[model samples]
Target: MHIALVTETYPPEVNGVAMTNQRLVRGLLAKGHRITLIKPRHQEAPPAEHASLQVHEVFGIPIPNYAGLKLGLPRPGELERLFEADKPDIVHVATEGPLGFSSLRSARKLRIPVSSTFHTNFQDYCADYGAAFAARWMMAYLRWFHNQCALTTVPDPSLIQRLEKDGVQRLQMLGRGADTVLFSPDKRDPELRRSWGATAHSPVALYVGRVAAEKDIPLTLEAWAAARKHCPELKMVVVGDGPVRKKLERQWPEVHFAGMRYDEDLARHYASADIFIFASTSETFGNVVIEAMASGLAVITYDYAAGKQFIQSESNGHLVSLADRQSFIQCTESVIQEQSKMPPIRAAARATAINYPWSATIDRFNHLLQKAAKTEQITPQIDIVSNSEQSTL
Candidate 1:
């Protein structure tokens, strides 16, 4: 099947959504599906394209206060023209940005079936950014945008129930996968641990994600501080860049900040660590949790998203009650104190990650696209004339 994938983020962006989309596109191509990827052109370098994958780059602008990331401007007419020229069998909107809205409008205008994916919790993000009042407006807009599609795919059953309760229509639950080969216990580097001032015995706690307010970085820091009281030699390593990095760096000079490691390097960082710490509660799906688990690290996360979906608490990994800061810190201390039992726990975590392969996720996504293509098209209610109107948030 020929598919048109519309997204604001893509490869080289160093985000979960971009990486997942790239993997899905490659998987679909391997399955003999032609995909036309519509995304914002990178400022530095363009990504390599495949024979079956056609990449259409559009104008984009850097997101405010977020370096190394760009938001694509909507191009409904251009998208319409491109679709008219080639005419894909189905359209998959991977983001709810302007580009996604434009793609939905274009597909609707041409009477083509379209489906969407709810990857980010933008409403929750608004609360983090101190714009909590805008969450209702944003949710209303999101409902309007996604309701135009034949189906809206979510990551887990919890999210599906919440979205359905909030008036989101036609919700489908789909799980994500991790690259086990790339992220494995075998990739652990002793030399890398030495570089971070960590010995074979000293505990090294790792955090791999955006160091932003939404991630609840303060809670992670508090937990780390409390854990260090019991395990004095414990080293904390943060592996990601975000708007809050500079401020956090100044605040916690003892913690090692390894800004933005990708692919093999990222896996190495994850494997070298003894424990994985994630305190974020605003995730539709936390990809880093699975990646860290695949790398054989004893994960400590809240009981939600990937943690709730995959972790079996004391058996595989440790999970604290959602939003309970005291429980999170206590759990960390308990896990650190029982360091001797971590080997089996890490092995169990890796075994669990091995069960979730990327091929399964790709097959599920492809099946959904096929189903959407076979379904009837829904006409769009909003009128879109040019990029100017659609580009505005």
Candidate 2:
């Protein structure tokens, strides 16, 4: 199968969508498939080195308030030429950016099957970015984009239901997985823990993700502060960088801000922590939650998406209601107060996380692409020319 995967981001970008795309592309290549990977280029990273993979770089502009990430520009003319030369069996649109929009148009014009995956909750992000009024318009555009594809893949059932309610057709459930081998309890380093002023007996609360408004990072800090009141020795470390990292670091000088750790280093940071707090409500599926769980950290998150699917409150991990912000803080404090139950909870989390492997997710993704290629395409009613010319959100 020759699969042309189009996205605005890819590996060395340190985001969930980028990492997931890399994993899927590698998995497909391993199964003896040719891949044409098209994405926005990053100066620090080179094109993927694979015999079966062909990478095409495109021009992009930096997104507002998002540092180190680019919004890929539409290249309809270039894409049409590329498709004409070596037509792909299927084109998978990962991100609904300008580049992805152009790819969809090109593939449709060439009469090729196309599929898309709903990765981010851009509609939910509107409120965080002070553009709450645009959320409805965002959803409308999203529905129009995905409805055009033969299949629209989502990470969780909750998301599938939400999109269906919003009138998105051809929806399918496709879950993300954690790398248990790389992110295991065995990766725990006592030296690293000590650097964060944590010891064997002392607890280290960890938060790993973009330190941005949408992540509800303020809630994580508030929970950590409240938790520290009961257990004065409790330490907090935030791993990952974003637009607000500098401001947050200055605001909370006591907390350790370990910026942008990747691969094995990222796993080590996860293993060194005792508790993981992910308060973000806007997620298709929180990849970090599963990774933290795989690293044997008792997680505390909202009762939805990955948390609701894998965690049993007070068993494997903790779950708070999305509507109750106060309850999240209380839950974090209570989890810290009961130190005796930590080992069992952590053990259960790791055990459950190991069950979900990347291999299974890859197999399912491949099946969806193959199935989509055989299905008839649905012509979208929206004007592709107008949409492609519009500015990227």
Candidate 3:
């Protein structure tokens, strides 16, 4: 099948959505599916060449407060022209940004099947960005945007329930997978640990994601600090960059800020750590959690999405009640203090993570896209009111 994949983020951008989209593209390509990629041109360097993949980089504006990310601009007419030139079997919208919206509009206008995936909880992020009042508006927009699609794919069942409550229709669960081979216990580097001022005896706590307020990074620091009191040699390393990196660096001078590490480097960082602390409460699904688990680290994350799905609390990895900062800290400290339990927990984590491979994810994704393509095109719900020969969505 030929699929037109539309997204705002892609490779070279160190984020879950970007990485996941890249993985999906690779998976689909491996399955012999032709892909037409549409994304923001955040950099001048073109994406890597692929035999079955076509690239379309569009004009984009740097997203405010999100360093290294871009908000794709709308190009409906341009997209329509491209689609008409080489029509795809289905349009898979991976984001809800302007570009994705335009892709949906153009595809629907051409009576093509279009599906979407809800990767991020954008409405939930409104409160974190001091726009609590806008959450309702954001959610309403999301409901309308997703309902227009033949089906809206979600990462977990919890998100499906939430979206359904919000009036979004035809929601399907599409779980994510981690590269167990890329992120494995064998990748653990003692030299890397030594560089972070951590010895074999010392416990290292690692956080690998955007250093932003929405991520609840402050809570990770708090947990690390509390754990440090119990284990003086405890080293905390944060391995990502974001808008608040500078401020966080100033506030937590003790942390080994490794900035951004990708591929094997990221895996090494995860393996070298003894425990993984992801305090983010705003994730639709935390990809880092599975990556850390695959790296054989005793993870401590909130009990939701990936955490709830993969973790068996006190067995494979630790799961704190959602949004309970106090429990999160206590869980971190407890996991560190019970040093003997780490090996078993890490082993169990790896065991669970390996079961979710990209092959299975890709199969499910292909099935969903096939289903979408075969289904009758969904009528777009957005009312088009024309004023002065202009149609507003």
Could you tell me the TM-score of candidate 3? Answer: 0.96
Better of 1 and 2 by lDDT: 2
Off by over 4 Å in 2: 74-76, 384-393
Instruction: Tell me each candidate's TM-score.
Output: 0.96, 0.96, 0.96
User: Pairs clashing in candidate 2?
Assistant: none
Instruction: Give one digit per residue, the lDDT tens place, for model 1 in 156-179.
Output: 889998898877898887899889
Clashes of each: 0, 0, 0
lDDT of 3 by residue, 26-118 (tens): 899999999999998866545556888999889999998787789888564999998898799899999999998899888888888999999
Question: What is candidate 2's lDDT per residue for 160-184, written digit by digit as tens?
Answer: 8888988899998988888999999
The C-alpha local distance difference test score for the whole of candidate 3 amounts to 0.90
Q: State residue 371's C-alpha deviation in candidate 1, in Å.
A: 0.3
Q: Candidate 3: deviation at residue 167, Å?
A: 0.7
Model 2 alpha-carbon miss at residue 184, Å: 0.5
